[model samples]
Structure formats: C-alpha cells, structure tokens
Target: MALIRKIIKTSSNEHYPFSVPVIENLKELDLEQDIIIFSGENGSGKSTLLEIIALKLNLVRISLDINYSDPEFSDLKAAINAFTVEFSLKPNGFFFRSEDFISYLRYLNKTKVEAEKELKRIETEYREKSAYSKILASMPHKRTLNELDNLYQRNLEEQSHGESYLDFFKSRLRPKNLYLLDEAEVPLSFQNQLTLMVLIKNAVAEGCQFIISTHSPVLMAFPGACIYDFNQEVIKEINYEDIEAVNQLRNFLNDRDRYFKYLFD
Candidate 1:
C-alpha cells in the first residue's frame, strides 16, 4: 500500500475568524511513510490535526478523546462525516482513547461470544446431517476455530497493561488500513517499547500505516520517521537522535553528577 500522498485542509470559519479567509496550508503536508510520528506538548493541536487527517483519509482514529465531545472536535467530526459520505470507505474504523480500552475489551469479548455461537451453530448443522462425514469434512476448519478460541482466551488472560495493548493491536489490525494511535505507549515500558516498535515495523511491512502521537523517546527513535516539533512550531524531517526529548534524556543520563549537584546546590 502506498503512503498518504497529501492532506489538504481547506479554509473554514470553524477554528479561525471568517475574515481570515480560507487557507489550505494545513492540508499541504505530505506524510508518505510507513510510520508518521506527531509530537507536541499537550493542547498543541496535535490531536486535532490527527483527527482531521484520519477523517480525510477514512483511516481509523484511536485516541483518548474518542468518547468526549468537545468544541475542539467539531471540525474533525464534520470533516470525517463529510468524507465518509463522499467516499465509499468502510466505517469500521475506530478512534480509541486511553480510557476507552476497557470498553473496547468488553466489546471484543462480546464479539468473541457471538463468533462462538456461530461456530457452534455451524457444527451442529453439520453433525445433524451426518456425524462422521461432516466431522471429517470440517476437521481442519474446526481446528482453526479452536485455535482462535484458545488465542482469544490467552489474550483475555494477559493482565499486564502493556501486554493487553499489544494483544489488542495484534487482534484488531488489518492490512491496508490506517491506524491513528495517540499515546499508544502509555502502558509500555522501555523494553516493551522496543517490542512494540518491532511489531509496528512488521505491521507496516504488511500493508498497514500508522500515525502515532507519543512522548516515548523509544518510539520517537523509529528510524526514518518524520518529526514535527509542536513545541517549536516547526516541522522537519529528523532522526531520533535529534529529538529534544531524547537529547535531554541522554544528557541527563550521561552527567548525573552535574545534574544532581545543581539540584542540591
């Protein structure tokens, strides 16, 4: 799958004054990559921008603000609704915020139950026809279903927050789909961040694209990612080494004595 070639944000009085006129500068950004990182301080319009882009592209938008409706989301919702009506993109995409995970897990569990009912119905139909013949014919498929059920159970048993998030990702991701993740590393530790990175890389290779907003230095370090510095109101393509967060972290670790002395002094 090709990367998103362009994002065009036409001018609207939604956020700005009517007299300011319509500007398309926001839509002019070109994000064509396997993974695009959106970095900014809180309330820097990062989430809003992601919402707009996800709506425009008909990609799944997952963040902490999925349920809460606010004036900030007005433009985003309008844009998404308009795009969905105009295009034939599937509405199966979703936007999940941090707190939404619990609800999401509950929804998935309900879906698994439904799937199990379907599987049972199919099996019963086959058994009533000819027990041995239908069983023999469905042996392979039955095994697959059983495997899926086992996997689902194992996933449900994972109690670690990070593992649960990873499980959700593994189970929900589909090929050629757009996934917008906000603070996806919240539950992950440093080591798990590396594992998640590998998973993201693999997913990208499998025709999935990601737009993520995170503060994790480990995630920001993804090779060849475009870094937009909302703190500085500047956008540039840079390696992870150049990120301010990473640099500051490295500096502190490299000279703990100096930092501690300054603090004590």
Candidate 2:
C-alpha cells in the first residue's frame, strides 16, 4: 500500500492565489503511485501543491524548522491542514527544498571549519602540556578532524554546488520513506540530472516513495512517474512528451535556427 493514499481538500477559501488550484479542482486527489510529480511553470501553484502534500502527510523534514511558519506558506498550510489523509504507514521522510540547500551547505562548511579550529587548539594545548598526556588523548574532539576526513573523504565545500546538493540528498534519503522535493533540479546540470534520475529510480525500487515538483524535462522523464500537469490550472496525469517543458525543448532542439529567426524577428 502507498504511504499516502489520497488528499481530500476541505477548505473553500480562495483568499490566497496559491490555494486556488487545489480549491478549484482537487476534491479527493489520489496518490497511488510510488513516484508522483507535479510539473508546471513558475507561480502556477505546483510548488504549493507539493507543499500541501507534505503538510497533509505531516512529514518531518529539515525545512520544517524554517518554512512552516512563514507568512507566504500560510495559505498552503491552512489548505493542507484542512485536508484528510489515508495512510498505510506512519509517514517518515525528509522534505528537501532546493532553495534551502545553499544555507545547509554553508552550515556544513561552518561546522567543518569550527571543528578544524577546535582540533588545532587542542593540538597546541597538548603540545604545551605533554605529548603523552592521557587527558588530552581522551578528549572527544581530539580526533574530530581525522574522523571527518575519514567520513566525508572529500569536503562538500570542495566540490561544485551540484555535487554538494547530491551529496546532501544521498545522505538523507532512505528506503521506504516518503520524500517531498520542491524544484530539486534547480542546481543540477543535464548530466547530473540524469545521475539523479538513476538515483531516484533505484530508491523507488527499494520501496521509497517520492513527491517531486519540477520543471525539468529530464526529471519528468523518470520511468513510471505519475506526472500531474498544472499548466491549465487543473491537475491531470500527463505523458512524458506531453509536458510543456519537454515539448518546448523538443521544438527548440528540432530547429534552433528557425526558432531563433522567429524569436529575433
């Protein structure tokens, strides 16, 4: 059974633009697939829907501490809270907001830097006292730098942003959990998106469920993902090629010169 069977909207308030899409259409939205995607242009309310699903499922994520109380998400919070969910298991997963990634990476970098500073301080203190001092040897932070070196192998800060984001993602993802991701493709290149697609595919095979909101045609092509199109302002399942982003890219790639001529002229 799927973790979240469906979300039934209970509010009729259209006071917020973000709430309009769900209020206008979804009475009882079914989420039977393991991989569900919400795709649409920016500000078309797809990210709001992804947030609604996360709220309704009562997901526990790092983003919860920062975003749940923001005034901008107030409408989505209210709308999703009003909805009822049928669950097969108690939901467990992280909600990864791509927008929050940079701050998260910065925190990691700061943590590593502080750890290094502390280790240096400890090293100097040990040298001043005695190299064989048991007290200094027993300090928990004495070997922190070595431990970090062994654990991370490569510091996330040393890699590209896309690589760091993927590292963050892989560290948090676990099997049989329901993950809610918003605009996950933002930091990725074309090749990295393909790598991420493979990761998603493998995670799904291991009993994980994902609710992703994105405009990337690369991500939209994930095998067997139930894609909901939000362009028309009514949620409907769509094929990979039918996605507007995919269609536009296809058209642009098919004849770039012709498109340039029309665009420029």
| Local distance difference test values of all predictions, in order | 0.63, 0.76
TM-score of 2: 0.85
lDDT of 1 by residue, 178-202 (tens): 6777777787888888888988888
Tens digit of lDDT per residue, candidate 2, span 1-265?
2578887767566556334664467777788888888888887777776666666667765552475576767755665656777777777887788888778768766767887677777677777676667355545664665665665546778889888777767766687888888999989999988988888888888888888999888888888889988888678888998888898999999999999999899
- Highest TM-score: give the candidate number: 2
Q: What's the residue-level lDDT of 213 in candidate 1? A: 82
List candidate 2 segments past 4 Å from native: 64-69, 121-153
lDDT, model 2 = 0.76
